[model samples]
Target: MQLLYACVNVCVFLGGLAEEVDEKVLHAAFIPFGDITDIQIPLDYETEKHRGFAFIEFELAEVND
Candidate 1:
């Protein structure tokens, strides 16, 4: 079977985050690194709050530097 993967830029995985952290906080904290394309924070269904982690996607792979 051929596996197809989507093209993605530099992505950062952050764990052990506080539930209070949100997209805005992440954007502000990471913007100095590079242009951020997206931020995803998974939430707990019961509390409707963040799951103590997030994914940050940068516009360019160079952000890995």
Candidate 2:
């Protein structure tokens, strides 16, 4: 079986203030997922900050479950 898993990590600078988080912070949070094949974090070019979410791809279904 072929399976793909996507995960998102959000960081709130002031807790409940999602707008205050940075892209770097979000990226750092995702580091522990382990064996991630692909990662994408959309950000605002003007501010160069995280959109408060991320997308990660894992090739193995069993690893996620």
**Candidate number of the best TM-score:** 1
State model 2's lDDT: 0.52
**Candidate 2, residues 35-58: lDDT per residue as tens digits?**
455555566689887565655554
**lDDT by residue for model 1 over 7-65, one digit each (tens)?**
38888888999767889999999999998988888778898888888889889754353
**Candidate 1 segments whose C-alpha is farther than 4 A from its true place:** 1-7, 61-65
Residue-pair clashes per candidate, as listed?
A: 0, 0
Indicate the TM-score of model 2: 0.41
Q: What is residue 47's positional error in candidate 2, in angstroms?
A: 0.7
TM-score for model 1? 0.78
Which regions of candidate 2 deviate over 4 angstroms?
1-34, 61-65
